[model samples]
Target: MDVQGVRAAYRRYARHYDRYFGKVFHDGRKLAIEQMAILPGEHVLEVGVGTGLSLPEYPDGVRVTGIDLSPEMIQHAQTRVEDLELPDVTLLEMDASAMEFSDASFDHVVAMYVLSVAPEPERVIAEMRRVCKPGGRLYIVNHFRNANRIISSLERALAPLSQLLGFRPDFSLDEFVAHNDLDVLEAHPVNLFGYWTLLTAAREPTCRGGASPDLERSIRSH
Candidate 1:
């Protein structure tokens, strides 16, 4: 889907996102966090954190930063943070494919129901890997194309409508994992009827250095 098209579609959905998606995807959200095994004081970055639905699920004392592309959706997330008086939570309107955070800035990075919606899933995963510490974990929760012939066919048939639906229905998990070179630790079905999946992986240390001093310095200065 086009980035602008996604932004426009989500702008309309932001107001009623919770009503439609909150309860339906709650289990996947919970499972993803549980598997992360987050430790206190670990810095966590959540990509595509629409409306902050998973904000309260994170344990206290972990610094949490969430980013989304849609300004309209992020406004709701900001409100959720303020309403809950959550300390150490930051919300920003930003694109996942090109994040501003310094390399290895976060201990853990997560993206829930975001891969299929991203205009470039590979770039988004690359950014997630770049910002995350080597030993840190990465979690993803999303729906992939079904295995059943009929269901899979239906998903492919609906791919053309993604611009209107805000997400592609025919995203492939196997291709995504292979293309991104993900080192998956575990994969499990989540949500009703096993429609969604939760995947966990570790960020392998890159030969490159840790957090970029210039980037971190700029981020701190702001």
Candidate 2:
């Protein structure tokens, strides 16, 4: 889906999104934040922070900057920040694939249920790696294509309906991991029936010249 399509879909869903997905996805959000282990005064970035459902879960003293492409979704998030009196949170209407922050701007970055919906998942991952400081944590939670044959086939069949649902049903975890030079720390299932996977990785420090040529080649080859 294109940016405009994403915006339109989320705009239409913003009012009722929580009603539909809030509790269902709450566990993954909580788990991701807990795993972050955000220290006091650290800066965190959340890409595709729809409606700020996870804002209140963050502890005090840590600053959070959340970005999403949908203005309507951001409006709801803004209201959430106000209602909760979350002084350290900020929400912006911005694209995840092309962030405007300086390099290594955040101490930690997370994207829950976003990769499958982003227009360019690889570009989004690159930007996530770019803005995160070396050794910083990266967390992702999303529903990936099931490995089970029957379910995998069902997901593939429903892939075209993403234009209406706002997320692709056939996103593959193996493909995403292979295409990005990420230092994966851990990956586990979350939510009911193990429908969502929580992935944790770290941004490796850049070498003298740049990232290792071999790593770049491997990612490109994939």
Each candidate's TM vs. the true structure? Answer: 0.91, 0.91
Model 2, range 61-172, lDDT digits (tens) per residue?
A: 9999999999988999999999889999989989999999999999999999999999888899999989999878789898888867899899999998998989999987
Candidate 1, 18-123: lDDT as tens digits: 9999999999999988888889998899999999999999998989999999999999999999999999899988999999999999998999999999999889
Runs of candidate 2 with Cα error greater than 4 angstroms are: 205-222
The lDDT per prediction is 0.86, 0.87
> What RMSD does each model have against the real structure?
9.5, 5.3
Off by over 4 Å in 1: 205-222
Q: Give the deviation of candidate 2 from the true structure as CA RMSD.
A: 5.3
